[model samples]
Target chain A: MYTRILVSALFAGACAGLIAGILQLYFVQPVLLHAELYETGALSHFGAVPISAHPELPGFDLMRDGLSLIFTMLIYTGYGLILLALMSLAEDRGAVISGRSGILWGIAGFVAFHLAPGFSLPPEVPGVAAADVTVRQIWWFATVGCAAAAMWLIAFGANWMVWGLAAILLLAPHVIGAPEPEVFAGPVPTEIAALFAARAFGVGLAAWVLLGCFAGYFWQREGVYADATQSA
Target chain B: MTTMTNTRSGLRILPALFALALGGAVIALTGHVQAAALHDAAHDVRHATGFPCH
Candidate 1:
């Protein structure tokens, strides 16, 4: 059972990663490269102070992009494993993951991973000012954890009290609030940042939606059928 | 194929092992080396999560 879950996750994740990587290369990378030029003084935004040029790393663009693709693939594949494991567990309890309702699973994956966190922190473009990384990382993890739990409860929680609690947890992160930059000063233009943010969000949404559908489809293929008797 | 795990445990374990190793290597590489693009991607996720992982 675990082996089936693993293979399914690897294949599905790789597919999502390949699709997302291509999408990012086209829709997202150009925007990032554009912003980097500003960051590196190869270009400037609104005549911002002439920033010092940092030494370029070896392998340059090619290495970075390759690594980006590899990293993206790895991350999604790992996520796939987790999602499949969850589905199997859910199946054990009689939830059927099939072609028909898989897209709903995909949407849930999107909401839990991308939308929930996105609501708190929209994607940032290159050279944009932001708060300390550690604090933000902690908060972001907390939010993903809370939001994921809340979403699960919303989906499968049996009681109204569970739903009420889910609502509170969902709101908890926002109420506590994400940490903000002390001063929002960066060289990137607002228009460019806005475009980048929107595109990035779109990219994630598309990828995660794909993740969900793939996970659900592959899971069913692995033989997790609904047992009518158990479901009752 | 499904029964392989029951009879030939090794084959069943191969895929999981391979994935684990590949996943581990990638994580190790990303952890030690800070490539800007990777950093940017992580930053986007972190920032999207409203977290600053740098």
Candidate 2:
């Protein structure tokens, strides 16, 4: 069972990571590079006037691109392992682990890891300033944990009471509020920053949706689908 | 039957251990193991994807 999960996670993580890495270079990286210009003062937000023309990667920046690919794969593999572990636990409790089910799990994973944390802390451009790292980190993890539990309750609970509990769990961290910086400072203009934020969120949504589709497909393909056999 | 039950218990033990080890590696990489340039490379993606690297 462990071997099946390990291999399946590797397969799903590799494919999804590859796609995500590619997508980032195209969609996310340019915005980042643009932001960096403002960060470094190489270009002003309105300096060139034509926002459509983004800079290209330097001709020999292989090391940078290579590292991006490797990191993307590693991070996605970590996500896949967690996803598979959850499925295994669910199956032990007699829940069916199928592609369809994987889709749901994948969405939950996205919400837990991405959307939940993002609600309080949106993605930032390079030069934007904000809260202390430690406080933000603490709040982020708390949000993910609460959101994950809430999502599970909402998905599997048998009654309205459980749903009510889920709602509270979902909102508890937000109610406490995310830590804020004393002041906001950055070189990037608001318009460019807004564009970056939108693109970043859109890219995240796509990657997470693909993660669900791929995770579900790969997990189910490993014979976890339609099997009454519990391997413990 | 006793042998089958024992094997099943052993199987259960291993995946939990496997999951633990995997989880540990993840924590280490994202936490303590984050060095300078690597963290810088990862930082952008982490922040962009809403992971807490701020």
Candidate 3:
């Protein structure tokens, strides 16, 4: 059983992470590279040459982009491990797990991991002013934890009080508020920042959906094989 | 039957715990680590995937 769970998570995570990394490379990385230019003062928003609507971005560097791809896979695989663990727990509780249901799981994952925290602390560009990293990280982790708990309650809770608690869990973090920098200032244009945030969310949604589907599929397959081996 | 189910569930718990711990550690390393080299290596991804970063 342990090996089955581990193998399922590893395969699912690797597959989903590869696709997510590629999606990031294509849709998200260019915006980041562009933001870096403004951050370094190479392309200033208010400079002599106003930034063009579609300025030429730096071409990909193999080293930088390659590292990003590998890291993305690692991060998503970590997410996969956590997700599969939860799914396994759910299955033991008599929940049916499958690729179809996994889409909903994926959406829930996105909401918990990305949307909930981002509601207050939107993704930022390279040069953007922000709160201290440690403070922000604490808030981010808290929000994700609360949101994940809330999602589980919403899905499996049997009564109104449980639902009520879920609502509180969802709202508590935002009400307390995310850490913020006293002054909002940065070299990157707000337009660029906005674009970056939107694309980040978009890629996140796609990757998570894929991750859920893959996780669910592999998990089911592993269960079948485990049973077959037992019978054999 | 009840004892069999209990034993099976008990077997399941250890792996689930292990997965959660390992997964959480990997995410912390990639997304939350504070070292400069780690930050630079994960910079673009940190931004792209929406992990909070400098």
Candidate 4:
């Protein structure tokens, strides 16, 4: 039973991690490259590089980057934990796939993220073009928030307190707005937003811990004796 | 008479109360209106399948 749980979680985590990595490579990376090209004409030559135009690995850079890795791990961890949690429910009832419960949880989480804002780390150098900021900043937060919340509520519960608290803890700084310090004496518009994304992803890491515990409970199975069948 | 009394007693309010609580919870949790992203995604997904949610 324990081995099954571990195997299921590892499989789920690896798959989720790979998918997340691919998304970063194919979608997010190109967008970043485009933003850089729009900002500094000098960087346009670098942007012409096919590698920059297309990200071949999604979550690899995310894993390597100190901040991005945190989010990638959160996604991977969440998937594994969720799988475990559903497995536990089946163990309690019987050793079978509770397809209904599993799909319900998955859909719920997916929907929550869809409704919430997207999130991502901001670039170090501020860009001159408004398009770059607007596209990356607003869209990313909205999309990520929606996606994260959907996943969270399903994996956790519909308890508004849990949902709202998770959202606030993860996204408050960005969603509520952050105060930018002027020690650098520079206007960095995406700094606060990026902070919020980073913080929210951190909260997601904590949530994944809950996922692991719940998964363990759900996947725990009781031994069945052959003689027990006589009672039925 | 005893069986009728027992049957009446067995039909308790707990299940009804539990159902009410669950329903209330579902409403409370989902009541907070969200942005259009989910709806948009659903729309897109549905359109691709030629079965629009609209």
Candidate 5:
């Protein structure tokens, strides 16, 4: 049984890493590459190769740079491990298939963003100055607001009622207060910072998964092995 | 699921292993999506819970 649990976790961890790596490469990376900060020089210092300049696959404009690699590794190494933990905890075969609970916790992670104080917007493009304090703050708030709504739907439920309510709530503030770009002299590389931050979060999330997997694997294994020996 | 294809010691552990792997992949792919927002949400929840992981 101990071996069983260990094997389970290892298997899960490997799959999580592969799929997460692919998803990041295909979907998330593109969205991030288009961010304002990536266009700016903010992320250039991370490595010699610029992500925006990288050659993308046919029909896929996604660019892979240090920043994208950071995000991919963050998901593959960290978040992938966490999923292993979750699988160990579920125990039952059906639990693995029923991913509703896992998704809720995922949303909970997103909703937590509303609690942040603020963030500074980096320069827009290469050779531009950073965004002004007000612009940064507003951007932070707006982003947080949108995230809050999205997370609420995720954490609570993605049902029509929940989604509808979240949609209304999301649109309310936007109608009254649209986030306008702040007047800044240099290009605001805020998007670059956002990309980095997102990748960092992925790393942290992966850590959480790994920790859970290890704990659950050992905990279950110890109990099962003891029981098996006793029965024998 | 390939884990189940090869049996050792008459134990059907491979299927469970594959299932776990599949689940892990899903979670890894979906878990940290919209993560900045989640970070903020967690920040708020932590404060509300009075744990303060900062």
Candidate 6:
């Protein structure tokens, strides 16, 4: 069971991570690179004449971009391992696991990890004003935890009371509120920031759906093999 | 048969726990670590994935 879980997660994570990395490279990275120009004062949003017709956006560095790709794969693999473990537990409780249902699982993951926290702390671009990293990190972790528990309750809980509790869990972090900068300030333009957040969410949704599909497919395949071996 | 099933399920707990732990550590390293060098290394991704960065 352990080997099966590990193998499935690895394959699912790698495949999803590869695609997610490429998507980010194509759809998201340009926005980020443009924002960095503003951040570094290479281009200024405020009252400064334009630097040049075409400010040289940093071209591809193999090392930096390559590492980013690898790191993305590793991060998703980790997500996969955790997700698969939970799915195994659910399966033990007789919940059906499959590619069709995996999309739902992936969406739940995005909600817990991204949307829930983001409601309080929208994705930031370079030069954006922000709270201290440590405090924000704590809040982010708490939000993810609460949101995940709430999702689990919603999925498995039997009664309204349980569902009500789930609702509270989902709301608690927002009620507490996310940490904020003393004043909202940044060189990055609102348009860029908005685009960044939107693109990030879009990429995240696509990646997670793919991850869920792969995980479910691999898990079901492994289960079939296990059954065959047991019967044999 | 019931006892066998119970034993098998019971043995599953350790691996499940292990998977959770391992997965969590990787996430923390990639998404949550505060070390400057690591942060610099993962800077672009940290921002791209919306993991909160400086």
Per-candidate clashes come to 5, 0, 0, 33, 34, 0
Q: Candidate 3 docking category?
A: high
User: Can you tell me which runs of candidate 4 are displaced by over 4 Å?
Assistant: A37-75, A86-101, A111-232, B1-54
True contacts kept of 3: 0.83
Query: What are the per-model DockQ values?
Result: 0.16, 0.41, 0.85, 0.03, 0.04, 0.76
Encode model 6's per-residue lDDT on A1-232: one tens digit a residue. 8988899999999999999999988888888898888888777865656444345677778988898889889988988998898888888888899988888999998898889998998877878999999899889989989998999999999999999999999999999899999997788878888999999889988998988888888999998999999999
Interface RMSD of each: 5.7, 2.7, 0.8, 15.3, 13.2, 1.0
Candidate 1 chain B minimal-lDDT segment of 10 residues? B44-53
What candidate 6 gets wrong by more than 4 Å, as runs, is A48-56
Here the TM-score of candidate 1's chain B is 0.47
Worst 10 residues of 4 chain B by lDDT: B44-53
Considering chain A alone, what is the TM-score of candidate 4? 0.39
The TM-score that candidate 3 achieves is 0.97
TM-score of chain B of each: 0.47, 0.60, 0.94, 0.42, 0.40, 0.86
Q: Cα deviation in Å at residue A228, candidate 1?
A: 20
Candidate 5 Cα outliers beyond 4 Å, as residue runs: A1-14, A31-77, A80-100, A113-232, B1-54
lDDT of 4 by residue, A26-83 (tens): 4344343343343445333324463343323233333234333333433444455444
Which of candidates 2 and 6 is the stronger one according to DockQ? 6
Kindly provide the TM-score obtained by chain B of candidate 4 when compared with the true chain B: 0.42
Worst 10 residues of 4 chain A by lDDT: A114-123
Candidate 1's C-alpha runs over 4 A off are: A48-61, A224-232, B1-53
Task: State how far residue A207 of model 6 sits from its true place (Å).
Answer: 0.5
* Candidate 2 clashes between residue pairs 3 or more apart in a chain or in different chains: none
Query: Against the true structure, what is each candidate's TM-score?
Result: 0.76, 0.84, 0.97, 0.34, 0.30, 0.95
